[model samples]
Target chain A: MNKNLYIKELKRNRKNFFVWLSIVFGFTLLVLSIFPYMSGMGEGLTALMEQIPPEIGKAMGMDEQTWSSALGFYSTYYGVYIVVLISIYTASTGAGIISKEERDRTSEFLLTRPVSRKTVFWTKIAALFSLTLIFFGLQTVLAGIGLSLVNEGTMDWGIFTRMHASGFILICFFTAIGVLISMFFTPKKNFMGMVVGLTFGTYFLNAIAKSTEATKWIGYISPFNYMEITIDPHHAFNYWGAIVLILVAIILLIVALKSYEKRDMAG
Target chain B: MLAIETINLSKLYGENRGIRNVNLKVERGEVFGFIGPNGAGKSTTIRTLLGLIHPSGGRATILGHDIVSEGVELRKKIGYLPSEVHYYDEMNSRELLEYSIGFYDNINPDEIEHLADFFELDLAKNIADLSFGNKKKCAIIQAVLHRPELLILDEPTSGLDPLMQNRFFDLLEEKHKEGTTIFFSSHILSEIQRMCDRAAVIRDGEISAIENIQDLLKKQMKKVRIVFNPDAINRNLPIGSQNEKWHDQKVNFEYVGPIESLIQWMNESKVVDVVMEEPDLETIFMNYYKR
Candidate 1:
């Protein structure tokens, strides 16, 4: 990877990174900080939880434990809001990372420089995942701090780790899909709508699949199905699923790099 | 080794667009001009050589490196100025130039400041706010700051005023003196006439003719109009004159031979007034196109 290009890519996306980071930061803290208050209402919240439609609760990965523990409460939001928000930021960024140069017509200037297309491609990808990992790690750390501060009772760190691990894998899977999608579309296209649609659309697919026994087969098509974020002590982390998703991400990135190498930069 | 060489290089966009079977050899330190009108495949050929676009067939080399397989190394020695400049709008001229410099090795960053000052470009101004001419100036500096061995310039002076154009040409002349091989592409005839040693004429995606600039000028046809005295109406016209037309006491024709011979013929005739017109390059190209 070209260091200079990698650095420039990072610097270019700095503002967008900070914006998304703050949103994730706020959401993580809001979910965790509110957990203590919800748990204090204890039986009252449990009564409220029972009143919620079981289908709705299942769709959102929420349960009785959602009002009982900090990690359980955070896990509900983690599976739906937090992971999807981070994925949207990362996936949209991945879509635009390379295509933006073509859209802006600066590829001519860049490709003519003393750098191979391969170098440029991998450098940008390196920068992209670096941002992804940082974003994912920071949110995890923030949630960790919030969870510890709010939970007066002993918390299950293993479930917390498992939930975040699955969240990271899902985010990466979506981000790779974003990069692959950009390769097929015209550079001038705004990828935000498509990226958002793919992330939310797949999340809803998993949610609907989980809520109904009839549609459970549909969950197989979504990466979220393989990488579950529900904080259940009975279900272990999906190590095999994580490996498959990572391999798929790698394949998507390689396909994108191949297409980028051969593309004729239109002036 | 040649500075630039292409063997049957072709890039067909679809059925009839882009360049085709373009073969050229530009010698080291030679100022070779590529003359063509817009959409005449000049930019297509250059872009293919620079590896911005993959060639449909055939191959090329610049500075002894294969354009396809060795583009990165070859580009290290090449300086290209595109006709339409598009830079990162977020960067100021200094930052853009600095980022550009980072792509190569051993480039003195101070050269960016020097070139910016020389071209009267304000380094602090955002690229989005700069005028076309100012952007062109920035591009010019970016192209030459590294003192590259081969300069591929496409319509290099289009946006610059005459003064900046002159300054640009002067800078090019200086680079030429330092043994830089210039591949200049322009439709403007005067600029080619001033700088080119030899020129290749491309039209409709193919090369029609490649001739020495001196030979081309020597063979050029001039439009001539002569107003003769009434007494001289029946006199014979010059030897190299063609399509002579008589209108009362005045005659109009095209002269295609040596200027001295035409002058001598006129001196012997009873002429009251004479007008001579040098046809522009487009008209000369039209002659070739018609053939």
Candidate 2:
């Protein structure tokens, strides 16, 4: 990968990075802060859960049985917000990374340089992956702080690691898919629409699948199901889901690189 | 060795033709002009040579490297300015120029500063705030700052005022004096007339003619008008008179024959007045299109 281009990509992405970082941090803090108060009123919380239908609870990825624990509450409620926000971040970055040059009419300048298409493709991929790591790492740190502020000495570090690990891996999968989509379509505005569509489309599909037994097989097609936090087992990491995520990510990345190399660039 | 060569180069976006059977050769240090109207394939040919778009057929080479197989190496010795200029809006002119210079080792900072001064461009201003002409100045600076062996410019003066256009030509002349080969592509005929040593005229995705600028002007057809007294000679016109019109005592046509033959015809006819003038490139261009 070309260092100059990689650095240029980093500079271009820095502002958006901070904006996403603040959003995830603020959202996580607000949800985690309410956990302590909800745990204190156990009967009221239980009564509220009882009033809500089981199908709705499952659709929300909330655990009715483990709603009392700090990590359980976070994995149930705070988890969805984190995943959704990061997915938007990853998908948007992946969509914009290479196509933005064309959209901005700068491809004529960049592609005419001495750098090979392969180097350019891989450098953009590297930049996207690096941005994902930063987003994930910063969110983890802020989540840790928020959990400490409300856990009252009962927070489980092991469960936190496993949950975030699965989330990070799952984000990688979605990011690769985003890059794959970008290779086919161009200009920033159109790519963003596709990013939003695919991210939420799969999300709602996964929810729909969880709402009924007849549709559970549909969840297999959605990346959201691969990293879900299961309740009965107590926030255990899904190894097979992690495996599929890694494999799919690798395959999509390969397709992206090949397609980018063969495709024509417009100024 | 030739600075640039393309053999039967062609590009097609599926059924839409970009360029067809284009062959060009430019010797070292020669200034070559490519003239065509909008969508006439000037940019397409240049893009193929730079590997920005792969040729659908045929092949090309620049500075002795195959355009595809050795595109990276070829690009190191070449500079290009596209038809329209766009830059990273977040950067100031200085930052963008610095980023461009980073790609090439051994670029002279003093030369870059001199270019910026020649254009009267404020390097500290952000690109987003710059006018179209100022952005064009920045594009020109980046393209030539490397002192590349070959420079390809497509419609380089579209946004520049006449003064800036003259200054740009002077800059290109200086580069030419230093033995850099230039391929200038434009729809405007005057710029090509002022700058090019040889020119290739393309129409409908194919090269219609390639000739030295001076020769092209001299050999092109001349418009002829004749006014008769009361009686007009109805005798058959000369073999080379094209699209003749007859009305009252006036006759107009285009003549492409020896001057002596025209003089003989004028002497025989009851001609009160005879006017002959060479047509400009625009007229010639239109005539080519008409064919």
Q: Tell me each candidate's TM-score.
A: 0.95, 0.88
| Consecutive 10-residue window with the lowest summed lDDT within model 2 chain A | A227-236
Per-candidate local distance difference test: 0.91, 0.84
What is the per-residue lDDT of model 2 for residues A95-182, given as tens digits with 9 covering 90 to 100? 8888788788787788888889889889989999999998899888988888888786676787788878877887788788888887
Per model, state how many residue pairs clash. 0, 0
C-alpha positional error of residue B146 in candidate 1 after TM-score superposition, expressed in Å: 1.5
TM-score per model for chain B alone?
0.91, 0.86
The DockQ of each candidate is 0.84, 0.57
Global Cα lDDT for candidate 2: 0.84
Kindly state the fnat score of candidate 2: 0.73
